[model samples]
Target: MSTEISIKDAAKQLNISEQRVRTLCRQGELESRKFGNSWIINAESIDKYGLRTAHMVAEDHPAYNVNEKCKKPIALSFFSGAMGLDLGIEKSGFDVRLACEVDKYCRQTIALNKPDTALLTDINKYSANEVRLAAGLGKDEEIDLIMGGPPCQAFSTAGKRKGLNDERGNVFLKYIDLALELRPKYFVIENVRGLLSCPMEHRPHEKRGDDYPELGLDELKGGALNFIINRLENSGYSYSFNLYNSANFGTPQIRERVIIICSRDGVKPPYLVPTHSEFGSDGLQKWNTVKKAISNLTSHDHLTFPEKRLKYYRMLSAGQNWKNLPIETQKEAMGKSFYSGGGKTGFLRRLGWDKPSPTLVTHPAMPATDLAHPVEDRPLSVQEYKRIQEFPDSWDLAGPIIQQYKQVGNAVPISMGNAVGKLIMNLLKGNEIPSFNNFKYSRYKNTSDKEWKEQFSKQVLKHKESTEQKELGFG
Candidate 1:
């Protein structure tokens, strides 16, 4: 038997769309056979076609001009998982000189794609000068930008919400210190929407009730984000941040993240303009949907649902969840979680082909966050995850199957990254950015940069007032 790979993998390896691969098979440009509802592609045919892999640039390629783009701004990336953000920055014409990551697999993935680029293993171990040297930058060189999404689980609502108390959260502060040390002209920080609401101190689970007594003033209403803003302001940097839904920026997923852009010169950064709208309002294209993103995929390899859960999945249709099943069946499927307070939407959930996918979780088979395919009984395939995250088809994730899912799921959507890149480019070029009025930044509206700053100021003032009162023995 000849060596073979699934059509989805073949598409990824060949750096082409899955539909294009099928077209090649139909035109006898490649050899393939049907396996159930999927296609098995001949690995030998892929090699014979001389298709260039993703991230590999031949010196003779038309896109290759070593000296023409030498003036591109330089960037240093921290917590660069799979380089999704870096890729976006690079696409926007920034030269990513180095990336810092601690995960072995992520480091492998980065090294695989960016062999020449310096990969710093641990942020804590390296000094600012060391990072600069690793990136081949001299001490006198001006670092144009530093960007990354520090670990967000500490602030993620789904997690412990430890804020600055958690060691990972401390790393977030360290990231800020590093940026200050490097004194880059600009810096970018990205995190989950949960960061907006995460309190500086984690409230005890037993005391989480609405009727619980109000906390002291030091425990302000705004979360760690306020502290971050205060630090930046005091450090003489001006910043703007807003929550953004990736769908608004042409990604095929409804993932939301808080993007904070800062400038060392104390000038407020402009907002990122959305290129797509939910209903095609504002003269933008309607948000891309899951169907459009993966309809052409002829093969998939996904995590298997247990036979027990598979039965319920078989009964559900696209856009249907446990709620769509019969009352008796719903109870049977949900078990103890059925009586829980929340919507329990993820239980027995099937994606809607027309809708953008819900945020991709690290695991698709979790009880509370299942991401079952719309019609298929199984979870989304690894290839589908890559597509939804906007990672190039040929980008190789270095890990086991489960680890691959986690890497892709945790990535910032490539489209969102590209949008950030564009914003940075515009700022660098000193171009005036166009504005959108009445823009909905995330699922929640009114999260504009101005509104966020106003809210943050209020919380900071409250904290200061409380501190002064305590000093005067008025506590």
Candidate 2:
């Protein structure tokens, strides 16, 4: 005849330490009765105590809103890898109805943190109506926002740069198709900075002989982006896109990505407001540093450099890379890589505590993209990566160690996601954003939409001119 919860569940529901819960029970501050060594906390007592603890614990926990009514403007996330973007959007007060992801590891992570949210594994298998139903939406109901970053390897400069010709690139196109079908009021598509300059057709390295011919003059320099824009325009949506550095928005890393914001009613998309600046100019705070982000951590597991690389890391100081070593030592350490072109800054690099971390790579041990710790002899740990990406301490990321690294490395920094979410919320509410024309949004300033288009035109024209001459057999 008695309804009660075990002490553990009470602590969990109250968002407090179990010891604190037990102490309260012992003191009779909480309405509970002890059953031998175990405490039988009255269910009513938990409800009463939760109200008081909810306010105090809400700042650091997600369970505080258990009894609150659901907010409006629901979102459906596609390609929701580890839900970093979804987390940011949720923080902005939007309810995420469902998430679609395909990667097994990423799906596990999402399922672990977002147990209540419906998750679909293969997007290709579901129609928009099916997805809506899966999200617990009525067939006639409209989704307020759709957002995701499709797999970006096809457009990544670090990869083969296959653009739309690659199967993954085709999947990017499918996401756009799904967005059109869903008819969301607003949609955001994010991708790598390389997408800004990717050509429509894959251009093989010229040294591979004349097997691959030059592309025609009519080809756009950023073929994939232009195609996406054309498709959205034809579907009666207006959009604006810009390359953003995550550090500009308060994340502690210098990760850059392209975000395209589209509105169904053809309204011009507003730019993301900057919260930090590189040097504290324009009334903004200085960029958060890696030291501030992860320096307080006690010992945790991390990937270590092989002894061969550790030998070189030992000789470097904070902020120094392979280039900082004595010239003879650099040669001795780098061997063949010493003569390689490009900055090669990632080689034997030790991060500086005062500056934002260089963009995180999927694997930190690669010679070309090493992310060795500032004073430690190992790569940044999974915990450090989470902090750098601005993921909450309590957010669970489920996977093996390597998979965890990929999930964190590939995430859109939560701060950047929050900025995007805020812009969408403002648009939804018809709020006029204050202009800060003088503000710098990144270490490299954001390129205006017009400026980007003009630059693209010039690059395409330049390439066309060169290609035409080659067709005429005139150098």
How much lDDT does each candidate structure score?
0.82, 0.81
How well does model 2 score by local distance difference test?
0.81
lDDT of 1 at 439: 82
Q: Lowest summed-lDDT stretch of 10 residues in model 1?
A: 56-65
lDDT of 1 by residue, 1-475 (tens): 7999988887887688899888887787778887887778888667545322222221111111224237889888999998888988898888888888887667667756666677777678878888877777778888889999999898887887777889998999999999999999999999988788777777776874445644654345556777888799999999988999999999999999999999988999888889999999999999999999888887776888999999988898998998998999988988888888988887777889998999998899987899998898889998999888889888867666787888888899988989998997898889989999778878885576678767767877776786677678675
1-475: candidate 2 lDDT, tens digit per residue: 6588898988888778899999999998688987999899887666545533331121111121322255578898989998889988888878887888888777666655665677787777788878877777777877899999999899898888888888988889889999999999999999988887787776556733455566643235677777788898899999987788899889999998889999998887877888888998778889999999999978565788999999989998889998988999999989998887888888898889999999998888888899988998999898898989989877666556787889899999998999999999998999887666756554444365666778777877787787788789875
> What is the Å distance of residue 312 in model 2 from its true position?
2.4
* Steric collisions counted per model: 0, 0
Name the top lDDT candidate: 1
Residue 163 lDDT in candidate 2: 86
